[model samples]
Target: MRRRRGFVQFAILHLLKEESMHGYQIMKELEERSNGTYSASAGTVYPALQELMEQQLIELDTSSDKKVYSINENGVKHLQNKHLEGDFWVEWKERMMWRNSEQSIQLRGAVDRWEKEFRKAMKHARGNPESVHELIAFIDDMTESLSKKSTKQGDRS
Candidate 1:
Protein backbone atom coordinates (compact mmCIF):
# COMPACT_ATOMS: atom_id res chain seq x y z
CA MET A 1 0.00 0.00 0.00
CA ARG A 2 1.05 3.55 -0.67
CA ARG A 3 1.68 5.43 2.57
CA ARG A 4 1.36 9.17 2.88
CA ARG A 5 4.52 11.22 3.23
CA GLY A 6 6.02 10.98 6.74
CA PHE A 7 3.42 8.33 7.57
CA VAL A 8 6.11 5.82 8.41
CA GLN A 9 7.89 8.27 10.68
CA PHE A 10 4.71 9.19 12.50
CA ALA A 11 3.74 5.54 12.97
CA ILE A 12 7.19 4.51 14.28
CA LEU A 13 7.49 7.29 16.80
CA HIS A 14 3.87 6.93 17.86
CA LEU A 15 4.39 3.26 18.68
CA LEU A 16 7.76 3.89 20.29
CA LYS A 17 6.08 6.15 22.79
CA GLU A 18 4.44 3.07 24.28
CA GLU A 19 7.41 0.69 24.61
CA SER A 20 10.74 -0.26 23.10
CA MET A 21 10.20 -2.37 20.01
CA HIS A 22 12.42 -4.03 17.45
CA GLY A 23 11.98 -3.14 13.78
CA TYR A 24 10.05 -6.32 12.95
CA GLN A 25 7.80 -5.84 15.95
CA ILE A 26 7.16 -2.24 14.92
CA MET A 27 6.12 -3.39 11.45
CA LYS A 28 3.80 -5.96 13.00
CA GLU A 29 2.32 -3.31 15.28
CA LEU A 30 1.60 -1.06 12.34
CA GLU A 31 -0.03 -3.92 10.48
CA GLU A 32 -2.14 -4.88 13.48
CA ARG A 33 -3.20 -1.41 14.56
CA SER A 34 -3.95 -0.34 11.01
CA ASN A 35 -6.13 -3.40 10.52
CA GLY A 36 -3.84 -4.98 7.89
CA THR A 37 -3.00 -1.59 6.46
CA TYR A 38 0.33 0.31 6.61
CA SER A 39 2.59 -2.70 6.83
CA ALA A 40 5.91 -0.95 6.37
CA SER A 41 8.69 -2.98 4.85
CA ALA A 42 12.12 -3.24 6.49
CA GLY A 43 13.43 -0.88 3.85
CA THR A 44 10.84 1.70 4.88
CA VAL A 45 10.90 1.21 8.68
CA TYR A 46 14.71 1.01 9.11
CA PRO A 47 15.34 4.26 7.31
CA ALA A 48 12.67 6.01 9.34
CA LEU A 49 14.16 4.65 12.56
CA GLN A 50 17.60 5.76 11.46
CA GLU A 51 16.30 9.23 10.70
CA LEU A 52 14.55 9.42 14.07
CA MET A 53 17.79 8.37 15.72
CA GLU A 54 19.75 11.00 13.82
CA GLN A 55 17.18 13.56 14.92
CA GLN A 56 17.64 12.29 18.50
CA LEU A 57 13.92 11.69 18.88
CA ILE A 58 14.44 8.05 19.70
CA GLU A 59 17.09 5.93 21.43
CA LEU A 60 18.22 2.49 20.47
CA ASP A 61 19.41 -0.29 22.73
CA THR A 62 21.21 -3.36 21.42
CA SER A 63 20.91 -6.22 23.84
CA SER A 64 20.10 -9.43 22.00
CA ASP A 65 21.15 -8.87 18.40
CA LYS A 66 18.07 -6.73 17.90
CA LYS A 67 17.92 -2.97 17.87
CA VAL A 68 15.12 -2.07 20.25
CA TYR A 69 13.89 1.51 19.87
CA SER A 70 12.34 3.61 22.60
CA ILE A 71 11.13 7.16 22.63
CA ASN A 72 13.51 9.45 24.47
CA GLU A 73 12.86 12.75 26.18
CA ASN A 74 13.05 14.56 22.88
CA GLY A 75 10.60 12.12 21.34
CA VAL A 76 8.22 12.55 24.26
CA LYS A 77 8.40 16.30 23.91
CA HIS A 78 7.79 16.04 20.17
CA LEU A 79 4.89 13.69 20.70
CA GLN A 80 3.36 16.03 23.24
CA ASN A 81 3.95 19.06 21.09
CA LYS A 82 2.27 17.38 18.14
CA HIS A 83 -0.65 16.27 20.32
CA LEU A 84 -1.00 13.01 18.34
CA GLU A 85 -3.01 11.02 20.82
CA GLY A 86 -6.20 9.02 20.54
CA ASP A 87 -7.93 11.21 17.99
CA PHE A 88 -4.90 11.35 15.72
CA TRP A 89 -4.32 7.62 15.92
CA VAL A 90 -7.98 6.97 15.27
CA GLU A 91 -7.89 9.23 12.22
CA TRP A 92 -4.78 7.57 10.90
CA LYS A 93 -6.39 4.16 11.37
CA GLU A 94 -9.49 5.33 9.55
CA ARG A 95 -7.40 6.55 6.63
CA MET A 96 -5.58 3.28 6.53
CA MET A 97 -8.85 1.41 6.53
CA TRP A 98 -10.06 3.40 3.57
CA ARG A 99 -6.91 2.75 1.63
CA ASN A 100 -6.94 -0.95 2.44
CA SER A 101 -10.66 -1.51 2.25
CA GLU A 102 -12.32 -4.90 1.57
CA GLN A 103 -10.45 -6.47 4.50
CA SER A 104 -7.42 -7.73 2.55
CA ILE A 105 -5.96 -8.36 -0.90
CA GLN A 106 -6.72 -12.05 -0.56
CA LEU A 107 -10.33 -11.40 0.35
CA ARG A 108 -10.83 -9.02 -2.54
CA GLY A 109 -9.46 -11.49 -5.04
CA ALA A 110 -11.40 -14.36 -3.53
CA VAL A 111 -14.62 -12.38 -3.53
CA ASP A 112 -14.23 -11.52 -7.18
CA ARG A 113 -13.70 -15.17 -8.13
CA TRP A 114 -16.39 -16.43 -5.84
CA GLU A 115 -18.88 -13.97 -7.30
CA LYS A 116 -18.23 -15.19 -10.82
CA GLU A 117 -18.53 -18.81 -9.70
CA PHE A 118 -21.81 -18.13 -7.95
CA ARG A 119 -23.21 -16.37 -11.00
CA LYS A 120 -22.28 -19.33 -13.22
CA ALA A 121 -23.82 -21.76 -10.74
CA MET A 122 -27.04 -19.77 -10.68
CA LYS A 123 -27.20 -19.75 -14.45
CA HIS A 124 -26.79 -23.52 -14.59
CA ALA A 125 -29.05 -24.22 -11.64
CA ARG A 126 -32.03 -22.42 -13.19
CA GLY A 127 -35.34 -24.30 -12.69
CA ASN A 128 -33.63 -26.69 -10.25
CA PRO A 129 -35.46 -26.63 -6.91
CA GLU A 130 -32.89 -28.71 -5.00
CA SER A 131 -29.99 -26.51 -6.08
CA VAL A 132 -31.97 -23.35 -5.28
CA HIS A 133 -32.85 -24.63 -1.81
CA GLU A 134 -29.24 -25.56 -1.08
CA LEU A 135 -27.96 -22.15 -2.13
CA ILE A 136 -30.68 -20.36 -0.14
CA ALA A 137 -29.93 -22.38 2.95
CA PHE A 138 -26.22 -21.64 2.68
CA ILE A 139 -26.89 -17.94 2.21
CA ASP A 140 -29.29 -17.89 5.17
CA ASP A 141 -26.74 -19.55 7.40
CA MET A 142 -24.03 -17.08 6.34
CA THR A 143 -26.36 -14.14 6.86
CA GLU A 144 -27.25 -15.36 10.34
CA SER A 145 -23.59 -15.71 11.30
CA LEU A 146 -22.78 -12.26 9.94
CA SER A 147 -25.77 -10.80 11.79
CA LYS A 148 -24.49 -12.24 15.05
CA LYS A 149 -21.06 -10.77 14.49
CA SER A 150 -22.55 -7.37 13.68
CA THR A 151 -24.60 -7.44 16.84
CA LYS A 152 -21.56 -8.34 18.91
CA GLN A 153 -19.57 -5.49 17.39
CA GLY A 154 -22.41 -3.11 18.09
CA ASP A 155 -22.45 -4.25 21.69
CA ARG A 156 -18.75 -3.49 21.98
CA SER A 157 -19.33 0.01 20.73
Candidate 2:
Protein backbone atom coordinates (compact mmCIF):
# COMPACT_ATOMS: atom_id res chain seq x y z
CA MET A 1 0.00 0.00 0.00
CA ARG A 2 1.74 3.16 -1.17
CA ARG A 3 0.45 6.15 0.75
CA ARG A 4 0.58 9.72 -0.40
CA ARG A 5 3.25 12.03 0.91
CA GLY A 6 2.58 13.32 4.45
CA PHE A 7 -0.02 10.61 5.02
CA VAL A 8 2.07 9.08 7.79
CA GLN A 9 2.22 12.40 9.63
CA PHE A 10 -1.50 12.91 9.21
CA ALA A 11 -2.27 9.41 10.45
CA ILE A 12 -0.04 9.90 13.47
CA LEU A 13 -1.76 13.11 14.39
CA HIS A 14 -5.18 11.52 13.92
CA LEU A 15 -4.30 8.58 16.13
CA LEU A 16 -2.82 10.75 18.87
CA LYS A 17 -5.96 12.85 18.93
CA GLU A 18 -7.88 9.77 20.05
CA GLU A 19 -5.59 8.81 22.95
CA SER A 20 -2.03 8.79 24.27
CA MET A 21 0.16 5.98 22.93
CA HIS A 22 3.76 4.78 22.87
CA GLY A 23 5.70 4.25 19.66
CA TYR A 24 5.03 0.51 19.50
CA GLN A 25 1.33 1.00 20.12
CA ILE A 26 1.15 3.58 17.37
CA MET A 27 2.77 1.15 14.88
CA LYS A 28 0.42 -1.70 15.76
CA GLU A 29 -2.69 0.49 15.71
CA LEU A 30 -1.82 1.76 12.24
CA GLU A 31 -1.35 -1.80 10.97
CA GLU A 32 -4.66 -2.91 12.48
CA ARG A 33 -6.53 0.11 11.19
CA SER A 34 -5.29 -0.43 7.65
CA ASN A 35 -6.53 -4.04 7.75
CA GLY A 36 -2.88 -5.18 7.91
CA THR A 37 -2.08 -3.40 4.67
CA TYR A 38 0.27 -0.73 6.04
CA SER A 39 2.82 -1.99 8.49
CA ALA A 40 4.70 0.80 10.26
CA SER A 41 8.25 -0.01 11.22
CA ALA A 42 10.14 1.52 14.15
CA GLY A 43 12.46 3.37 11.78
CA THR A 44 9.58 5.05 9.98
CA VAL A 45 7.28 5.67 12.97
CA TYR A 46 9.84 6.96 15.46
CA PRO A 47 11.15 9.61 13.09
CA ALA A 48 7.64 10.86 12.38
CA LEU A 49 6.95 11.05 16.09
CA GLN A 50 10.14 13.00 16.62
CA GLU A 51 9.21 15.42 13.85
CA LEU A 52 5.76 15.98 15.36
CA MET A 53 7.26 16.65 18.78
CA GLU A 54 9.62 19.21 17.29
CA GLN A 55 6.72 20.97 15.59
CA GLN A 56 4.90 21.07 18.96
CA LEU A 57 1.86 19.39 17.46
CA ILE A 58 2.23 16.63 20.01
CA GLU A 59 3.70 16.32 23.49
CA LEU A 60 5.75 13.50 24.96
CA ASP A 61 5.23 12.37 28.52
CA THR A 62 8.26 11.02 30.32
CA SER A 63 6.58 10.29 33.62
CA SER A 64 6.79 6.52 33.02
CA ASP A 65 9.78 4.53 31.76
CA LYS A 66 8.32 4.35 28.27
CA LYS A 67 7.60 7.62 26.49
CA VAL A 68 3.95 8.19 25.62
CA TYR A 69 2.71 10.85 23.23
CA SER A 70 -0.58 12.71 23.04
CA ILE A 71 -1.86 15.40 20.73
CA ASN A 72 -1.78 18.89 22.18
CA GLU A 73 -3.98 21.86 21.43
CA ASN A 74 -1.88 22.81 18.43
CA GLY A 75 -2.24 19.31 16.99
CA VAL A 76 -6.03 19.44 17.29
CA LYS A 77 -6.05 22.89 15.73
CA HIS A 78 -3.80 21.80 12.88
CA LEU A 79 -5.99 18.80 12.10
CA GLN A 80 -9.13 20.92 12.05
CA ASN A 81 -7.50 23.66 10.07
CA LYS A 82 -6.00 21.38 7.43
CA HIS A 83 -9.21 19.37 6.96
CA LEU A 84 -7.21 16.46 5.50
CA GLU A 85 -9.30 13.67 6.99
CA GLY A 86 -11.86 13.06 4.26
CA ASP A 87 -10.19 11.49 1.22
CA PHE A 88 -7.60 9.20 2.81
CA TRP A 89 -9.93 7.71 5.39
CA VAL A 90 -12.86 7.36 3.00
CA GLU A 91 -10.73 5.54 0.43
CA TRP A 92 -9.29 3.27 3.10
CA LYS A 93 -12.70 2.35 4.45
CA GLU A 94 -14.07 1.64 0.98
CA ARG A 95 -11.07 -0.53 0.04
CA MET A 96 -11.30 -2.50 3.27
CA MET A 97 -14.99 -3.15 2.77
CA TRP A 98 -14.52 -4.19 -0.85
CA ARG A 99 -11.60 -6.51 -0.08
CA ASN A 100 -13.57 -8.26 2.66
CA SER A 101 -16.52 -9.13 0.44
CA GLU A 102 -17.02 -12.82 -0.46
CA GLN A 103 -17.03 -12.05 -4.17
CA SER A 104 -13.71 -10.25 -3.85
CA ILE A 105 -12.17 -13.20 -2.03
CA GLN A 106 -13.33 -15.63 -4.71
CA LEU A 107 -12.11 -13.38 -7.50
CA ARG A 108 -8.71 -13.00 -5.86
CA GLY A 109 -8.34 -16.77 -5.55
CA ALA A 110 -9.28 -17.29 -9.18
CA VAL A 111 -6.85 -14.62 -10.33
CA ASP A 112 -4.04 -16.18 -8.31
CA ARG A 113 -4.68 -19.58 -9.87
CA TRP A 114 -4.83 -18.07 -13.32
CA GLU A 115 -1.51 -16.29 -12.80
CA LYS A 116 0.19 -19.51 -11.70
CA GLU A 117 -1.12 -21.43 -14.70
CA PHE A 118 -0.24 -18.61 -17.08
CA ARG A 119 3.34 -18.51 -15.81
CA LYS A 120 3.70 -22.30 -16.16
CA ALA A 121 2.34 -22.22 -19.71
CA MET A 122 4.61 -19.33 -20.66
CA LYS A 123 7.67 -21.22 -19.44
CA HIS A 124 6.77 -24.24 -21.57
CA ALA A 125 5.82 -22.12 -24.60
CA ARG A 126 8.97 -20.01 -24.62
CA GLY A 127 10.67 -19.71 -28.10
CA ASN A 128 7.47 -20.94 -29.80
CA PRO A 129 5.78 -18.11 -31.76
CA GLU A 130 2.53 -20.03 -32.36
CA SER A 131 2.11 -20.82 -28.67
CA VAL A 132 2.79 -17.19 -27.71
CA HIS A 133 0.22 -15.95 -30.27
CA GLU A 134 -2.39 -18.36 -28.91
CA LEU A 135 -1.71 -17.16 -25.35
CA ILE A 136 -2.21 -13.51 -26.39
CA ALA A 137 -5.43 -14.37 -28.24
CA PHE A 138 -6.77 -16.25 -25.20
CA ILE A 139 -6.15 -13.21 -22.99
CA ASP A 140 -7.79 -10.84 -25.49
CA ASP A 141 -10.87 -13.06 -25.81
CA MET A 142 -11.29 -13.41 -22.07
CA THR A 143 -10.97 -9.65 -21.61
CA GLU A 144 -13.58 -8.99 -24.28
CA SER A 145 -15.99 -11.53 -22.77
CA LEU A 146 -15.66 -10.05 -19.27
CA SER A 147 -16.08 -6.52 -20.58
CA LYS A 148 -19.28 -7.44 -22.39
CA LYS A 149 -20.68 -9.15 -19.29
CA SER A 150 -19.87 -6.08 -17.20
CA THR A 151 -21.50 -3.79 -19.76
CA LYS A 152 -24.66 -5.88 -19.84
CA GLN A 153 -24.87 -5.91 -16.06
CA GLY A 154 -24.47 -2.11 -15.95
CA ASP A 155 -27.29 -1.72 -18.53
CA ARG A 156 -29.60 -3.86 -16.39
CA SER A 157 -28.76 -1.73 -13.33
Candidate 3:
Protein backbone atom coordinates (compact mmCIF):
# COMPACT_ATOMS: atom_id res chain seq x y z
CA MET A 1 0.00 0.00 0.00
CA ARG A 2 2.90 2.32 -0.61
CA ARG A 3 1.41 5.66 -1.52
CA ARG A 4 2.51 8.02 -4.21
CA ARG A 5 5.26 10.57 -3.58
CA GLY A 6 2.63 13.27 -3.04
CA PHE A 7 1.64 11.30 0.01
CA VAL A 8 5.11 11.85 1.47
CA GLN A 9 4.55 15.59 1.58
CA PHE A 10 1.17 15.20 3.24
CA ALA A 11 2.49 12.62 5.68
CA ILE A 12 5.36 14.87 6.71
CA LEU A 13 3.00 17.77 7.29
CA HIS A 14 0.78 15.58 9.43
CA LEU A 15 3.72 14.17 11.34
CA LEU A 16 4.99 17.62 12.11
CA LYS A 17 1.57 18.52 13.38
CA GLU A 18 1.82 15.76 15.94
CA GLU A 19 5.36 16.43 17.15
CA SER A 20 8.78 17.48 15.94
CA MET A 21 10.93 14.58 14.78
CA HIS A 22 14.17 14.14 12.94
CA GLY A 23 14.18 12.81 9.41
CA TYR A 24 15.03 9.32 10.60
CA GLN A 25 12.45 9.59 13.33
CA ILE A 26 9.85 10.65 10.83
CA MET A 27 10.74 7.66 8.64
CA LYS A 28 10.47 5.27 11.55
CA GLU A 29 7.24 6.84 12.71
CA LEU A 30 5.72 6.55 9.27
CA GLU A 31 6.70 2.90 9.00
CA GLU A 32 5.60 2.08 12.53
CA ARG A 33 2.37 4.00 12.23
CA SER A 34 1.35 2.72 8.82
CA ASN A 35 2.37 -0.86 9.51
CA GLY A 36 5.23 -0.58 7.01
CA THR A 37 2.97 0.49 4.17
CA TYR A 38 4.88 3.74 4.02
CA SER A 39 8.52 3.32 4.77
CA ALA A 40 9.46 6.83 3.78
CA SER A 41 12.74 6.02 2.09
CA ALA A 42 15.64 8.22 3.07
CA GLY A 43 15.74 9.68 -0.40
CA THR A 44 12.21 10.86 0.04
CA VAL A 45 12.26 11.95 3.69
CA TYR A 46 15.46 13.97 3.69
CA PRO A 47 14.58 16.04 0.69
CA ALA A 48 11.09 16.65 2.00
CA LEU A 49 12.52 17.76 5.32
CA GLN A 50 14.81 20.17 3.52
CA GLU A 51 11.86 21.44 1.55
CA LEU A 52 9.81 21.97 4.68
CA MET A 53 12.71 23.71 6.32
CA GLU A 54 13.02 26.00 3.34
CA GLN A 55 9.31 26.70 3.50
CA GLN A 56 9.60 27.59 7.21
CA LEU A 57 7.22 24.85 8.23
CA ILE A 58 9.85 23.23 10.45
CA GLU A 59 13.18 24.02 12.01
CA LEU A 60 16.10 22.11 13.42
CA ASP A 61 16.03 21.44 17.12
CA THR A 62 19.27 21.04 19.07
CA SER A 63 20.00 17.33 19.42
CA SER A 64 23.15 15.27 19.98
CA ASP A 65 23.12 12.58 17.32
CA LYS A 66 20.48 13.34 14.78
CA LYS A 67 19.12 16.78 14.08
CA VAL A 68 15.68 16.85 15.65
CA TYR A 69 12.98 18.86 13.93
CA SER A 70 10.04 20.66 15.47
CA ILE A 71 7.14 22.32 13.86
CA ASN A 72 7.38 26.09 13.88
CA GLU A 73 4.44 28.43 14.25
CA ASN A 74 4.24 28.61 10.47
CA GLY A 75 3.97 24.85 10.30
CA VAL A 76 0.89 24.81 12.50
CA LYS A 77 -0.64 27.55 10.42
CA HIS A 78 0.14 25.58 7.27
CA LEU A 79 -1.54 22.51 8.68
CA GLN A 80 -4.58 24.57 9.61
CA ASN A 81 -4.76 25.86 6.07
CA LYS A 82 -4.58 22.31 4.78
CA HIS A 83 -7.39 21.33 7.14
CA LEU A 84 -9.51 24.05 5.62
CA GLU A 85 -8.64 22.62 2.21
CA GLY A 86 -10.83 19.55 3.01
CA ASP A 87 -8.98 16.46 1.68
CA PHE A 88 -6.03 16.85 4.02
CA TRP A 89 -7.82 15.25 6.96
CA VAL A 90 -9.03 12.31 4.91
CA GLU A 91 -5.58 11.82 3.48
CA TRP A 92 -4.12 12.10 6.94
CA LYS A 93 -6.49 9.48 8.29
CA GLU A 94 -5.53 7.15 5.50
CA ARG A 95 -1.86 7.78 6.22
CA MET A 96 -2.12 7.56 10.01
CA MET A 97 -2.83 3.80 10.01
CA TRP A 98 0.76 3.21 8.95
CA ARG A 99 1.41 2.99 12.68
CA ASN A 100 -1.04 0.15 13.25
CA SER A 101 -0.04 -3.23 11.86
CA GLU A 102 -3.49 -4.73 12.01
CA GLN A 103 -4.98 -1.83 10.10
CA SER A 104 -2.31 -2.10 7.43
CA ILE A 105 -2.90 -5.80 6.93
CA GLN A 106 -6.62 -5.18 6.81
CA LEU A 107 -6.18 -2.51 4.17
CA ARG A 108 -4.06 -4.84 2.06
CA GLY A 109 -6.65 -7.58 2.39
CA ALA A 110 -9.43 -5.25 1.37
CA VAL A 111 -7.52 -4.23 -1.74
CA ASP A 112 -6.89 -7.83 -2.68
CA ARG A 113 -10.55 -8.66 -2.24
CA TRP A 114 -11.49 -5.71 -4.38
CA GLU A 115 -9.17 -6.82 -7.15
CA LYS A 116 -10.71 -10.28 -7.10
CA GLU A 117 -14.21 -8.88 -7.20
CA PHE A 118 -13.32 -6.61 -10.09
CA ARG A 119 -11.93 -9.48 -12.08
CA LYS A 120 -14.97 -11.62 -11.40
CA ALA A 121 -17.27 -8.84 -12.49
CA MET A 122 -15.27 -8.31 -15.64
CA LYS A 123 -15.47 -11.96 -16.52
CA HIS A 124 -19.18 -12.00 -15.98
CA ALA A 125 -19.65 -8.95 -18.12
CA ARG A 126 -17.44 -10.15 -20.97
CA GLY A 127 -20.08 -11.45 -23.38
CA ASN A 128 -23.49 -9.98 -22.70
CA PRO A 129 -24.40 -7.02 -24.90
CA GLU A 130 -25.99 -5.16 -22.00
CA SER A 131 -22.81 -5.67 -19.98
CA VAL A 132 -20.98 -2.78 -21.63
CA HIS A 133 -23.84 -0.39 -21.00
CA GLU A 134 -24.10 -1.58 -17.43
CA LEU A 135 -20.39 -1.20 -16.87
CA ILE A 136 -20.41 2.30 -18.33
CA ALA A 137 -23.34 3.29 -16.17
CA PHE A 138 -21.72 1.78 -13.12
CA ILE A 139 -18.52 3.71 -13.73
CA ASP A 140 -20.45 6.90 -14.31
CA ASP A 141 -22.40 6.37 -11.10
CA MET A 142 -19.25 5.78 -9.11
CA THR A 143 -17.57 8.90 -10.50
CA GLU A 144 -20.64 10.99 -9.80
CA SER A 145 -20.94 9.67 -6.28
CA LEU A 146 -17.30 10.36 -5.55
CA SER A 147 -17.53 13.85 -6.98
CA LYS A 148 -20.58 14.60 -4.85
CA LYS A 149 -18.93 13.20 -1.79
CA SER A 150 -15.80 15.28 -2.32
CA THR A 151 -17.83 18.41 -2.97
CA LYS A 152 -20.08 17.88 0.02
CA GLN A 153 -17.14 17.10 2.22
CA GLY A 154 -15.40 20.24 1.00
CA ASP A 155 -18.40 22.35 1.89
CA ARG A 156 -18.49 20.84 5.35
CA SER A 157 -14.83 21.67 5.83
On lDDT, the leading prediction is 2
The C-alpha stretches of model 1 lying farther than 4 A from their native spots are 1-5, 101-157
Model 1 has an lDDT value of 0.83
Per residue, candidate 2 scores C-alpha lDDT tens digits across 33-140 of: 877866789988998998888899999999999999999999999889886545666665566567778898999899889989999999978999999999999999
Please say which candidate is ahead in TM-score: 1 or 3: 1
Write model 1 residue lDDT over 12-68, tens digit each, in one string.
888998889999999899888877867768888888899899999999999779888
lDDT tens digits, residue span 14-74, model 3: 8888887788888888777665555568988888788788888888977567798888889
Better of 1 and 3 by lDDT: 1
Clashes of 3: 6
**Model 1: ten consecutive residues of lowest lDDT:** 1-10
| Residue 138, candidate 1: alpha-carbon lDDT | 79
Among all windows of 10 consecutive residues in model 3, the one with the lowest summed lDDT is 83-92
What's the lDDT for all of these models?
0.83, 0.85, 0.76
Candidate 3: C-alpha lDDT: 0.76
Clashing pairs in 2: none
Listed per candidate, the RMSD to the true structure in angstroms reads 12.9, 8.1, 7.6
How many pairs collide in each candidate, listed in order?
A: 0, 0, 6
Q: What is the TM-score of each candidate against the true structure?
A: 0.57, 0.54, 0.51
- Those runs of model 2 whose alpha carbons end farther than 4 Å from true positions after fitting are 1-5, 85-88, 92-157
